[model samples]
Target: MKSTPLACAFAALFFPVIASAEAEPSGVRTNTARLMTTDAAEVIDAPVLGLQRTAIPLFAGLAVDTSLYADALLAPNLGLRWALAAGPHRVVLGARYTHFVGASTYSGIVESEAPAIQSFEPELSGPSFYGVYGLVLGPIQLQGEARYGHYTTDYLSFTGGAGFNFAGHWSVVAEAGVRVEGGSAFRAAAGIRYGGEGLGFGLGAAYVDLSDPALPGESLPVLPVLDLSWTFR
Candidate 1:
């Protein structure tokens, strides 16, 4: 069958293969690295593994990255992250004010998990700040982050991850994080990431224990790790 030009154009416009000129993998890349930007900065969403984020460049050596996925209940959140310019061999430094918030600001009564009733309202928005550091190698990226915040609960978590670009626009990524303060919580995931000049996607399976963290042999949540983003350079 002969394909029409219109069909080809439509496919090209929306289904182009994902690829990027930069490291593309998630990490705190150095300023000296190719296409270096805070676009790789860590957000509170998936922590070490990050999630959908947008980095608005504010200066030559700094950019602010924020994400809304950090809060599962859509609680009012504010996250600020800065990527301090550094060389590829040096650590890229930055910080977050808080994560972003979306809707759910009204006050009302809600149901609890125990079949209990409860009321909800916005509080004085707690303090949430984080320090991020990352380094980029040609096809390898590494990052570490620590965050302190309290929304429904208080936590201080440390996370570190590594990514290896094994093929064009494809990378193998793994991350592990733990909350040492407030309570014992743990998360670890290994997945693949895809990136184009602007769009990116991530998928993997993760183990998340929010209360007393213990590894369950075969009982794992499906689709625990998922990320999708379209960034504007």
Candidate 2:
């Protein structure tokens, strides 16, 4: 199973912001930042796959984050992230591995009598390295990240948003951003979240407009997204 370009795109585009923005204020320090993000794109229309993520503080201004997820197709993915903070900015380095365990056919139809059938490849995995800069200006936050992976894939993502605190314990958050990947792949998303001091949930929607390598001259339309996460400090 060749890694879906769409999945790579989603990871490169959204994870940085999700990880950096959710860290508690106390967790931020020079050379030490704890970041955690989930790969939830597979859950949009597929079966309910579980995601497990954890962050461990190693020492002064250094931390490690890891995640594992499996989808309905039985494709398993693993990722590890190392983060270091410099003043108000965070530097992130990570790698991912994905195993495609199921068989798939290129064509939709299958006939029992057919003697020969094409089989898709059984694995797609690679390493990725990226960096993120986070700045808080008054009540708003700004973030930007750039990533490069195997197969010459490159991505740049940007996000700007703010959170509102009201009623002492309630808060509302909104964000919007654009991701440009591989020079030709483009996507955009906006989302709103509500939560308290230690927990939060969110709903997001995105539109992907990019050339499909498998289908020449074809492009995909808007896609829906949903995500939820909690923090313990």
Candidate 3:
């Protein structure tokens, strides 16, 4: 199963100025900044930023954004976002729809087994809705989110993330989440990130909670992530 913070992302992008103009909630470069994959109640004001985001902040709690890469020629995508709260803490709701041509390559990948082809992969592509919350303190931000969709086996998911801003435009962040469908899966990641008006980036590692490697002497798998972006904020 998969989840997207389409609504929470909007609140994070457009609502930050509501609490205080000085409160740019993005301490890191991952769109909302509180988490790597999770999003906060802030906005991506610049033209382009982390992963693949091009956002246009329209007003106090409204913005327009596009997924530069994910909405590809083969995969059409669209969504809507609305921030429900205007205070220091953030609340938001949103929806997204995507049609992937060859989603099974990644979305349906399963554990390798003796039969070489254990099960047929399903094309999990459709509309998804989500809600997200953000809590911001002096220099720490926490976020929680939930999403539901029929994208894959009538899926549902919950994810949370935390970020600590230590210095100017520098912070540490971590996130963990679970997805439920025909089965349940857990994923987590932690790392440091930097968010600047003109440039931002992140360096971290991620691990998926799954079966261990089959071969002897083989350890668990850990994937490193390095995300970078530039913006004209």
Candidate 4:
């Protein structure tokens, strides 16, 4: 999914600050990061059949007086990350794979619905490589990273974000970027991280907005993303 301007703001607000004071946590040198998540959604209210022609169609039928349609979506992921420490800076890199499962079906229809309620089970996965430069000052840590990758359907994307570390173990991260291949779009994301030794975990979401490739002028959008990972020694 892609991110919106608002998502970036939330990540920035929640992270990049210190709430507690304590000694820097040890074991920040090993694997350093990991994440995972599962999700489901339902869509309703339509006079016709088949995928909606525009992004706005997703919310067109959410009122109290519309017919209801239900669909299930699942996204499962896995990742690994490592750091190469330098004198005053550190480099962080990683990769991820995501699968979108389940399907969208139309139920409760009594008569012929042209095209009928169909099923869509699409999957997106690829390698994401990134670099982060880190600096330590007193009890605060600051860093920046850039990433680029292509998914299974020949979709390419590039992203970059910054983060802050508190006492070395806990951190907040935010990213703003874009995706382009045949078409172009924008994205934003944010999350929290807990890392030590060869283990780490994170939670966050992203949103995306762009034109509908299957339709003209219309837009297709995805939102409310959750990301998770794990690092091995």
Candidate 5:
């Protein structure tokens, strides 16, 4: 089966588990949550991962940022982003790279009297380049991203979302995106968030459709999403 670039990108962002830690924020702080859906016939179940992004001013309107993520199914991934702040918007260009650690695989079928066996295999790794733009228009926020990379195969992805702040500490967000590699998949999510002043968390649900020529037509109806982050200044 071929893996779509969107699927690989989602796996890289959300499936990893990371220890919660605090960081001192001297510059602009931004954190995001992403949903990841494992391939329908893949070995592992879908998992949610949190993303932390920090921007340190390099000059007047330019800053440099970095991101790190890890999970049991994949190796530690790191990325660097270059950001420029405009009047009421921000633009970012970044690149991410990750290596595949071996994953534990289980037999598809188990005998009634025998235990299921597990095995492992290391997969290919590669890098991706992405661009993002964010716009703030008084109580509404809009964001979009495009990415392309190679990881065992070549893939491309596009995602866009919007958020509405109804209260000082409450907001609702919705996003939809698609990815194409050897095949294509679609994903959508909606959720609510709470927090202010460099700290926030959110809970949401996502749906994924992996109905591509290279994959069995499978869909994840509802997957949970958890996001947490803190920043210091």
Candidate 6:
């Protein structure tokens, strides 16, 4: 199937997950008491991926030098995120689209040799899928998530993170895990979160490295990312 169509389908799947997570926020529907978000307003993470900057496709098998903007290496590229609480349990769902525009250029040119600049632009787009299930215990919260995508050459990843809600409306979260398919590797991230009433937001970065030594000159090891979103209740 075309990448665009497949992304649409994947994006559609997140809605229900958001609904259920929003309905209850604490424990297994049957076990443990429910935990819920203290605020009712929707939250959006302006910086996604925490501190990481770039993610390369392991399956591509080729090295290409591309500018960050030309690469469209960012998320919430255009996305909608939603979350809900039930007592102390919570569910969060996010959907995002990432796009890359490719171009070519010639640095120097002589009068008779060749044109000064030449380039081509190709459309690159993919879908970002996110789901999180968590249980709140006192001042601490534990959450596990599964993420997959077709936005950057079909990849799958999983992560687990913990959050601490301190005095006032401030919280800190840290996560670590592995991403597979194309080029499998381990990634870690952490960031601060803030929210109140009907609004929430996060800022952070992430790091990713594929285990294969043969692919040494792959892409950059550090990927810097930014995420932003708005929720409607």
lDDT of 6 by residue, 118-160 (tens): 4223334777667777777765778777777785368788777
TM-score of each: 0.60, 0.54, 0.68, 0.43, 0.62, 0.49
Which segments of model 5 are wrong by more than 4 Å? 1-69, 104-124, 210-221
Return the lDDT, model 2, position 196. Answer: 36
lDDT of 4 by residue, 10-119 (tens): 87776655432233333222121221111001121222221111111224322111111111223344434444545555555545444434322222221124233243
TM-score of 4: 0.43
| TM-score, cand. 5 vs. native | 0.62
Query: Candidate 1, residues 115-139: lDDT per residue as tens digits?
Result: 3334443443566666656676767
Highest lDDT scorer: 3
Clashes of each: 8, 6, 5, 11, 3, 39
Question: Scored by Cα lDDT, where does model 1 land?
Answer: 0.53
Give the higher-TM-score candidate: 2 or 4.
2
Which candidate leads the pack in TM-score?
A: 3
Q: Global lDDT of each model?
A: 0.53, 0.43, 0.65, 0.41, 0.54, 0.48
- Residue 228 CA displacement from its true place in model 3, Å: 2.0
- Minimum summed lDDT over a 10-residue window in model 3 is located at 106-115
Task: Give lDDT: candidate 4, residue 188.
Answer: 72
Better of 4 and 6 by TM-score: 6
TM-score, cand. 3 = 0.68
Q: What is the lDDT of residue 79 in candidate 1?
A: 42
Cα lDDT of model 2 by residue, 1-233, tens digit: 78799999999999999887765343211111211221210001111112233344455433344443344345555555555545544445556555545434323333232335343243334555555555643333445555555533445554443343333333334444555555334445555443333444445565666455544555666555444445443
